[model samples]
Target: MSKVFLSAKLPAATTKILTDHGLTVSVYAGEGLISHAELLKSVVDVDYLITPLSTQVDAAVIDAAPKLKLIANFGAGFNNIDAAYAKTKGIQVTNTPAVSTNSVAEVTVGLMLALSHRIVEGDAQMRTSGFPGWAPLYFLGSEIAGKTLGIVGFGNIGREVARKARALAVNVQYWQPHRLTDPEERSLGVQYVEFADLVQTSDFISINAPQKPDNHHQFSAAVFKEMKATAFLINVGRGPIVDEAALLTALQQGVIGGAALDVYEHEPQVTAGLEKLNNVILTPHIGNATVEARAAMGTIVANNVVLLEQGHNAKFIVNA
Candidate 1:
């Protein structure tokens, strides 16, 4: 029988899918995340390993699992797995990419609105100091309508962001390594622009790109300096894409009017002073935390594992 190991416990229904296919499934039932030592010990006899996006399945882990045939990742992003090494070892890697796109896109737009309108700040004031009543120019905030929104890394989430932002009368422009065709651009109601122009001209900026070695810290001090002083930045991408220290400085000095981030350069350990800043809105990386998204991701994970066991090519293979 093909034995499968889960680094963390998933929905029972998901595990049942594997069992129905005649595969043995093992789940890590610990409260917190599984440690590196625990992971190394668990995968010894498993044919398939399912892990969270944050768990690191490095070359060392790969070498330890001689029977491992597949790494079925539970998240859209698969950066945690050493896919290239897995490929060399004749192992397949798969990610659930499509499941979380809408959930993340919705959070991206929600962050934009919260940041521009100071929603969090107002709520805090109403709870603590109490509202001083409405008056002209009292607790002023900007409207997203008629504003230029520049999107960095135009992929699934970025395109979705453009579609939603356009509904609010916001002009959307995007920049990526490959520019979309003219028809594609017009149909989406978005324009393709050079990266430099996008940063300088946009009233709001959203970073929706994946994390890559070449693109790490892409938004540094220099890029922040080029942005409009009244502009806002929204990052739902990987944490390391933006330099948190540099971002902290920018927020402190008003380099770019304000910012909202769902992910940080050092996740769970945000740079000092960011939490104290009222100009920035910070979230605990819940971009894909919706109940619907998680359920879909679980289904994809089970489906991929079942496919591989059935001698069929799995869907959403990252390391083909």
Candidate 2:
């Protein structure tokens, strides 16, 4: 039997799918992401490894696992892996894409609505001081209808967000490395604009782009300065793409209206004073945390392992 090591716990059904095929699976038994030491120990003698976004499958891991043939990521993005290095070592990498599209898009729109309407703050006020009454001027929340939403990436999640945002009567414009054709734009009801124009004119700015060297910290102090004071910033992607310090300064100085983040620049650690602010909403990276999405991701990971074992092409290989 081939030895498979799962870096962290997966849905039991997902584990069952692998076990049913007679693969010997070694799983991390504790809570949360497995520690670096544990991951190093676990990879020493495995045939395949499954990882979550929080776990980094670097060169060290590859070197440790001389028998490893596959690294299956449980998320859409494989940025956590050292793909180039893995390819040189003859280890294939794969990720479960599109499975979290609707899950993330739902959270994106929810954050937009929650931030715009002061939902979290309102809930806090109600629980602590109690609402005096339904006063019109008490908690003046902005209406999302008839507003412009600028998406930074026009990928699966971005398109899904656009579709849902349109249902709420929001005009969607996007800026990506590539532009969509007239027909595609018409089909998705989105307009392609330059990054500058999207930032300057949007009523809300949503970051959906992946983190890259050139684009890392792309939403820094300089970019925040160009946004409307009333425009909210929404991030449902990688945290490092936005400079947390710049974002903190922007919110404190009113450079932008407000912000909501599902992912932080520092994973599991939010910047100081961000949580204290009434204008910002923070989530613990639950973009694709739905039960359905996770189960599907687990299945994909297991299937990738099975496909490789059978000498067939995996479904979503990142570094072919």
Candidate 3:
């Protein structure tokens, strides 16, 4: 039987898929991330390793598992694993994509609404100090219906956001490295623009891009300055894509109207002073936290393992 090591806890249905296929699986049942030393020791004799996206499976971790054939990530993004190094080591890297598309897209829109409408602020006020009572200008907030929403990285999640935002009468525009064909844009009811135009013209901006070397700190102070004074920023994508220090500065100085982040520049460690700001809403990376998305990710990850064990090319393989 092929031996597998799961680095974190997952849904029982996910493990069942492996055991039912006659694979031996050992899972780390701890409350937090598995330590690097523990991970290095666990993979010594394992053939397949499954891990959460937050866990770093770097070159050292890849080297620790000489017999490892696959690294199945339990999230849509695969940047946690070093695919280039894994390919050299003849290890297949796979991620569960599209499984979290709807969930993440929904959360993206939710963040937009929460930030624009002062939903979180109002809720906090009600809980902490009691309601101040209603007045025309008591809790002024923006509406989504007439504002232009710019989405960065027009992939599955981005496209979904466009569809949903359009239903709310939002003028949705998008920018990615490659421009979509006219027909594709028309079908999605979105307009394709350059990155500069998207940042400058949008009333609200959403980041759904992946973490690539080129994308690290892509949203810098200069970029923030280009945005409208009343514009809002929402990031449901990778954290490192936006420089938190710069973002904090922007938020503090009113460089932009407001901002919301589900992911941070550093995992588990948020930049200081962000929580103290009323203009920003910070959520623990919960873009894919929905029950449906988590379950679906588990299923997709389990299916990939089964496929690889059967000597077939697994689905969503990032490394050849």
Candidate 4:
């Protein structure tokens, strides 16, 4: 049987699909993300390597896998995998795109509402001190019904977010590297705005961009300063998209109103002082944490492995 190594355990259904096809699947032992050293060792003999974005599949990992023919990533983003380097070695890389579009977009909107309404903070307060029946000024939070929402990346997830935000009566504006056609803009009910204008004018700014050289620390001190003091920042995208140090400063100085973050610049290990603040809500990366999405990604990973092994290109091949 051809060997397949998984850096992390995906849904059982996905694993079964691969195993049923007569492929041996080995998942890393123990909990949490597989350590760097272990991952390198595990890939040395595998024909197909399945990994999460947290694991780095660079030149070293690619070089170690002498029999590696395919690198099937479990998530939409393939930044962790060195696809270009893999191409030189004739090893293809594929990611499960669009599977998490609705899931991530749903989390983005949930984060927006959580921050706007201080849901997490309020819950904590109630648990600790108990809410006294009904007080007029106990916890006054902003409403999202009539606010402007600026989406950073107007891709599938961003468009889904726009569609949801419109249902809430929130005015939607988007800023992207490439503007959509006028007709597409009208259909989506979004107005294209300059990046600077979007940051300055929006009541809530959501970062939905991918990790790119130009997008690193895109939300820094200067950008946060330009945000309306009463505005909130929501990030469900790549962590490095926002500068952690600068965000801390902004929260401390009241540079912006508040922030709700799903991803962080340094993931799993959060930046210091983020949890202590009362104005911010931090979450483990749950953008695509739903069972449905994970199961779908598992299926996609299975398909990528089976198809690539059978001399067929995966539908989501990153290096075809």
- My TM-score estimates for the predictions, one after another, are 0.97, 0.98, 0.98, 0.98
Backbone atom clashes (below 3 Å) for every candidate: 0, 0, 0, 0
Cα error, residue 17 of model 1, in Å, equals 1.3
Could you tell me how far off, in angstroms, the CA of residue 18 lies in candidate 3 after the best superposition? 0.8
What's the C-alpha lDDT at position 81 in model 4?
93
Model 4 agreement with the true structure over 18-90: per-residue lDDT tens digits? 9988899899976878887888899989999999998989899999999999999999999999999999999
Q: Write the number of the candidate with greater TM-score, choosing between 1 and 3.
A: 3
Query: How many clashing pairs in candidate 2?
Result: 0
Residue ranges of candidate 1 with Cα displaced over 4 Å: none
Give me candidate 1's TM-score against the actual structure: 0.97
Query: On residues 214-298, what C-alpha lDDT tens digit does candidate 3 reach at each position?
Result: 9999999999999999999999989999999999999899999999999989988999999999989999988889888889999
Q: Sorted on lDDT, highest at the top, how do the candidates line up?
A: 2, 3, 4, 1
CA lDDT of each candidate? 0.91, 0.93, 0.92, 0.92
Q: What would the TM-score be for candidate 3 when compared with the true structure?
A: 0.98
Quote the lDDT for 299 in model 3.
93
